[model samples]
Target: MPSLVPPVLPGGALSGREQPTLYADGALTLRPFRPADAPAVALAFTDPAIQRWHTHAMASADEAVAWINQWRVHWAAERAASWAVTDADDALVGRVGLREINLFDGVAEVAYWVLPEARGRGVVVRATEALARWSFEELGLHRLTLRHSTLNQPSCRAAEKAGFALEGVERSALLHTDGWHDMHLHARLTDLA
Candidate 1:
């Protein structure tokens, strides 16, 4: 028996074409991750903040390379997509990506983090806005959600600046190294009108 409503986005919606490099602004670009970026990724995991929130650390460059390789698989599978956030000179400054993509529902979760040097520069906000635009317009997604620990003030601020509205808090929704954290759920819908 078929359901009355069909998938909002059909299969091959993302895998049909190559993942294109997205321009966030004159100063920032979102591009596919390269093997050379393993070092930067390994270095990023060493940051306590990244480790604490993300709950995983790359112990070596090899591990980072493997992690980078999986993004291609995820893209082909249409389950997720990730990009390296680079500066104008093409230096890896951060990362932004969509995870838990569901074509049927046309939704995905957004995640992002920046190197210590890249913080306070609004890089995440710009990258997120660019991703959101592509997700809604090019990918035909219905909704994009951004969630972060309530303690993560910077992430909360960035989510708001990127036009994600705060829906509510999920109490003790995530487990961190320290303890359970309350998560703030924010969302941006394609049809805001």
Candidate 2:
């Protein structure tokens, strides 16, 4: 039986084309992950801040390579899309992406992390804004959500700076090594009006 509402976006919306490299204010680049970035990715997972908030660590470059490869698979499956955030020299500064994509609903969740060296420079916020624009304008997504542990002030600020409005909090929505954390939910719609 068919539902009453039609799909918000057609099928093959993302899988039909190559993921494009995105530029942010000429200062940052968002590109598909490459195997060569494994070392930098592996090193980034070692940072205590990244490990704490994300709750997972890459044990080796080999592991990071596998993780990088999965992003391509996710794109092909149309379930998620991720990009490596880089600086002007193409140095890996962090990562950003949309996950849990629901084409019928035109919705996805935004996620990102910044290298320790790139933290204070607003890299994540810039990347998030760029990715949001692409998702709304290019991918035709109607809404994008971003969630973070309530204890993660930096992430909360980045979400707001990227135009994601605070919606509410989820009680004990995510579990970390330390314990379960309350998550702050933020959302951005394609049209604010």
Scored by CA lDDT, what does every candidate get?
0.95, 0.94
Candidate maximizing lDDT: 1
lDDT of 2 by residue, 1-193 (tens): 9989999998899999999999897589999999999999999999999999999999999999999999999999999999999998999999999989999999999999999998888898899989999998998999999999999999999989889999999999999999999999999999951
lDDT of 1 at 39: 95
What would the per-residue lDDT of candidate 1 be over residues 1-193, giving only the tens digit for each residue?
Answer: 9989999999999899899899897589999999999999999999999998899988999999999999999999999999999998999999999999999999999999999999999999999999999999998999999999999999999999999999999999999999999999999999861
**Model 2 spans with C-alpha error above 4 angstroms:** none
lDDT at position 41, candidate 2: 99
Screening candidate 1 with a backbone cut-off below 3 angstroms (N, C-alpha, C), the clashing residue pairs are none
lDDT of 2 at 30: 98
Pairing residues by index, what is the TM-score of model 2? 0.98
